[model samples]
Target: MALQVILFMTHRGRTQQLVLRLLQARRLFPEDRTGSRTRHQRIAERLGLGYQVSVMVPALLWVLTPALVDAMSAPAANGTAATRGTPLPVWAPFDLQRSPNYELVYAVQAVTNVVMNLTGLFLDVFFVTLMLHLTAELDVLNLNVASLRPSPVAPADSLESRDGDSLAKQASTDAPYTARGDSFRVRTSTSRFHMYRLLVKNIQHHQMIIM
Candidate 1:
């Protein structure tokens, strides 16, 4: 369960980083003067609008897992009278209330919970810092892209002009190819994120049952 959680968190971080890169690329390139959208711009906009919703799953799991574990391991409703009067099941490994090692088990559990909580807190802080940094970088990239412009020389039928026209035409036609590549990248990233999340959820369910 712990390993699965770690994997989930790692994938989530990767996805966030990919989104940041997409945003940076979009800001650096901006849209064409012809009013056409770039591949980076479309992907960045889609991810920026929807990525926050995906984060809620991990955030909720981080907050709720320890509480769920504690609740599952809580003493039975029949209470101390039952614990004192009845013998543990023959198949039981050890009785939580009667075992001499009970304190040690509880200490370990408490420490584990503390470690998990601290890890979650660190992840939250890291994500916030990353977002802020990305925002600043994005603003700077936007300024740079906006300041860039074509040379002021008038068009002509010279070799230099023909070469320039060909380059422009090539760049315009490459947008579809760029869009296709971006679509593949975005799909792969999102699929991996969702896959890890689902695995983590399954692991959580299993851990709850075991507890």
Candidate 2:
């Protein structure tokens, strides 16, 4: 959903943070397609897999936007064409047909975001699990035969969550507490719930996520 905010601010373009990192990464990993394998996964490490998600999540959300818009704009009725050109089964669940306007556009965006973020998170976790499973079939190969390739994997001790001391405290086992106004975390299996929560927050509070 942070990414959705970025794209909403950036308008479907390469995110500024991503563009900078991509350039930096390309410069470091100039030996593209060396026709061999490398244990270091230089490119992946240069721009962490989490950051690479910047490109993918937005692209997918873009693909879904039109379909969602189409669905929302369809007829108000919900049926399987037994009636006169009733709405599609998928679109009927949305509350769009009440009084379509600019408000509908915002609702469309929010709904799309909920779907996009949730789907992306699920796919991310799935891919990570698949990667861990691939360790069993792993093979060793060098990326460069004649050129020197530096190791990209950093010290394990340096890895840490930047969610911060406050967030850590919030997630800590001390007590279920609220921080900075009414913000309190909720457990979600899918990122959609997170997105849904944010949408509800912005709508109910009449504020925008400028950050």
lDDT of each: 0.45, 0.41
- TM-score of each model, in listed order: 0.30, 0.21
Query: lDDT per residue, candidate 2, 70-182, as tens digits?
Result: 56665557743222111122345655434463346545665665566666565455445434322211211112222333334333233233332233333323243343454
TM-score of 2: 0.21
Kindly list the per-residue Cα lDDT of model 1 for residues 1-211, writing each as its tens digit: 4674687577996656556664554454443343233333454555544554455456556545644664567577877433322111223366655555544454455566556655655555445544554454445344444544433332222212212332233322222222323443112122343555555544543332223
Highest-scoring model, TM-score: 1
Give the count of colliding residue pairs in each prediction. Answer: 0, 0
- Weakest ten-residue segment in model 1 by summed lDDT: 154-163
Summed over model 2, clashes come to 0
User: What RMSD does each model have against the real structure?
Assistant: 18.4, 24.7
